[model samples]
Target: MLRGVCTALAAVSATGALMACRSPHEPAPLTVRVDAGSVRGIAKGEARQFLGIPYAQPPTGALRWTLPREPRPWSGVKDVGKPGKDCAQGSPGPKNPSSEDCLYVNVTAPREHHGSLPVMVWLHGGGFTQGSGKDYDAVRLATEGKAVVVTVNYRLGMFGYLGLPGLAGSGDFGFADQIAALRWARRNASAFGGDPRNVTVFGQSAGAMSTCALLTSPAARGLFDKAVISSGSCGLRWPAGGLFPGAPADRPYVPVAQGQDDGLAAAEELDCTGAGALACLRGKTTAELLPHSPSFADHLAYGTRLLPRDPAVALRAGAFAHVPVLIGGTRDEARSFVAGAIQYDPELITARTYPRLLKEAFGRHAGRVAARYPLSRFPSAGLAWATVLTDASWACSTLAGARDLAARTTVYSYEFADEDAPNVNGLHVPDVPQGAAHATDLPYLFDLGGRDLLVNRERKGLARTMVGYWSAFARTGDPNHRGAPRWRPGTAPLSLAPGAIRTVDAAAEHDCGFWATTAR
Candidate 1:
């Protein structure tokens, strides 16, 4: 059952005059009737927020690892004043608790908007193992952009993506959940003062990968009018000897056979092997499953009805939804990942060990990689390593995907180059500058981390510009609007820096020419 606090008030009258009195009360509920039921949200400033609204029945017991089921209709008003518990995963913090029954979506809309505004649905990123939609506050997007915003919560790790044989639609339940949320939005957006037909799906990192997957999935066609992908691409793959060390360098999706192999291993570890393995696995408690959850390296299985082929392969073959796309990555995308490693082991990286590490990461191409990214050129071997992976794994790969997508529809690319962007909560490394790292662009788009981080005039201006571009794109297919810099479609990407937005030849900037010849 849902948990929250409510206060009762008493009315006093004298001489036919009445006044209501209470000591610090909750905001009056703002009720809206949706297809499933009536829900009461809370009003805060210019935005009305409906939090913890379930889009599907809880995926627990027999339903675990299966496609999401539609939530049952409710007879009375459902209280959605508080955020829902995040899907069961690694700890986000002490305050953000998680549960197996998490499949909620939060809506934030302008309190005094007129009829039929555009809708922007958000998907959070945590390598498909962590993060919740509640991590982002859409009030700034709803109030400033004048559009309705919806943030979704999907299953994570073992409960969400484990692929065992005989389980229908295994390893892709998380993707199914996202599609369900989009379907829900199409049916009920009008009740939240949003246009059902006009919707945009946007996300960063793993969330961005999910967006890319949806673009390629036949099941997700017609769900969204436009798409935005940040710091991720369908073509992104980390080679065995590359940035992620021992992990395989193939594309993100695993085949069904590999998924079943993983499932068998997990079952053996849990002592649930044999004919009744599926039943025994499902009967395990949350605590029993938490320690055995798969890492980020575990991937959603492809070649199913939902995704007939790999996302990159499907995109290149023109087998994806023909929708306008905004795709790009950060200028220094690998710094955050590399810096974290350096912090863990101070002696982990050094100038003398640079060439050896490169050989271990790049194999025969290590010599070429070492020549291009010499340790003498960078402040530390760690920075040099990050630069190589940033160009090869992120920038060049995303550009290749964008070129393929451009052939079918309008595709606009960008690179976040905020060299001095404020350090956000996660991805923090002591004494190392983040330099527009993986998720640094998040604060500019949403009031994430904290408002104080954006108090500076320059940061505030950039945030407004980003919001304008995002909302404008949701309204129309294009991100260009009046007052903002004109964004044009081309191979060159628009550089998003503090107080600056201009097109740059990102291929040349990141040395994609060298990577194209050497790396995958």
Candidate 2:
């Protein structure tokens, strides 16, 4: 119904051109013909944006939990003026919309580009439970970096990663959707003036974890030429008394048998049993299914034909895509989590409960952890706890993964160290001085909802530098460019702070030696 109205307006405007008359000063209409059909996009400044382009058929009803298939070719021009609905998940914000039919990708390209430009495909992060590709506006990256950018939407939660026994390839539907999007990009990038062979896949947090998974996934071997993993790594194993106790810190991969067991338990709880279980499950409404679905943050089943082994294990064996990788995390990644805990329970910041908390988290290594991260050293017990976990779970583990990746291919590591980086909206918790915490670097590249907060000259410069480095990496495998400082690989990670960008020994700075010893 909505599309019909748009099509009627297009037909009235002109015979073939699906756009209203505009002033001569205005930019021309943006349209690109792809495999499925021709899509009409919007022109903003010097960039052409095609939003909400479906790469696969809707994964709803009988198609639920199944691998994504190519979207049926449409006869008329598709109106890609706005973003499509995000995959079904808990509401990320009051304004965010989601649905089951959410396998879409958005493309942004420079309007004045000559030949094919490098393409950067982005994946959003929300712990695999929330977030949509539309949250990021890539106009800045497209115009300033002189590259074509693609943001993607894949299924989340039960719709994306339900691991039932009867349903083959159930848990990996999201990964498959991503691969399908890449295949679409490979086939249609030329329409948008993008080089399919020079595609770079980049993401942050859970998105970065997905990128790491793609590196090891047999199905994604040749889909991307390079990768940028931010604030996440694939080699981390949940430590005994670490940030997420009992959870795997690496790219969480569950065995097929374990996944099937969990799926059966979930089905039993939902009262969907016997031969009609899948039918019953699929028939349930979104409201009924949301409360019963397992936590989306849990690991997906690996060791299948799609993903043959754990990502970390596969990386160690050099059984992954040998693409150049840029990997790193923020300096105080755990501060935000610790600040939230302290806000909920003030006793978490008290010295009296510090050792007890350490014991609860560290198990047998409490004493050693306490000695290394004493309460006297930090401003508060919360800061100390945050520091310890930052080293153990994030910094050291990520560096370890970088080293392994470096052994096989070129690797560039970095640490965002701007202690007073502006906190993004929804993350500005009171009393929490988010010191370049997890995902703080997002604003430096994409113009998110809180782009105005980074208005200062220094922050703007950093954003420009980051965009340059990222775009340069997309153009070539290396991130080096003129005007920016020389970014050496694997020797010392480049420290990115306001007004300063240079190399620093992140391993020594984060006390990786102690973490490495304890991790082993």
Off by over 4 Å in 2: 1-29, 91-96, 240-251, 425-432
Off by over 4 Å in 1: 1-29, 91-96, 241-243, 296-298, 425-431, 449-452
lDDT score for candidate 1 against the true structure = 0.81
Please list the C-alpha lDDT of all candidates, in the order they appear: 0.81, 0.79
Candidate 2, residues 317-396: lDDT per residue as tens digits?
88889999999989988877667666666665567877876776667888998999988898777677778878877888
Question: Can you write out model 1's per-residue Cα lDDT over 1-520, one digit (the tens) per residue?
Answer: 1111112211221100111121213322278777788898998788899999999999999887779999989988889999889899874457756899999999998777455679899999888878888888899988888898999998888877787788788778898999999999988787777888899999998889999999999899999999999988998877653545444565567887787788788878899988988899989988788776755243777878787788888989998999999999899888887777777666656677677667766789988988898878887777787888788888898999899999999998899899888767355555446898889889888877325367678888888898888898888978887798889986579999886799998999889889888844
Q: Highest lDDT: which candidate? A: 1
Worst 10 residues of 2 by lDDT: 15-24
Error of 2 at 338 (Å): 1.8
On TM-score, the candidate that comes out on top is 1
TM-scores for candidates 1 onward, in order? 0.92, 0.91
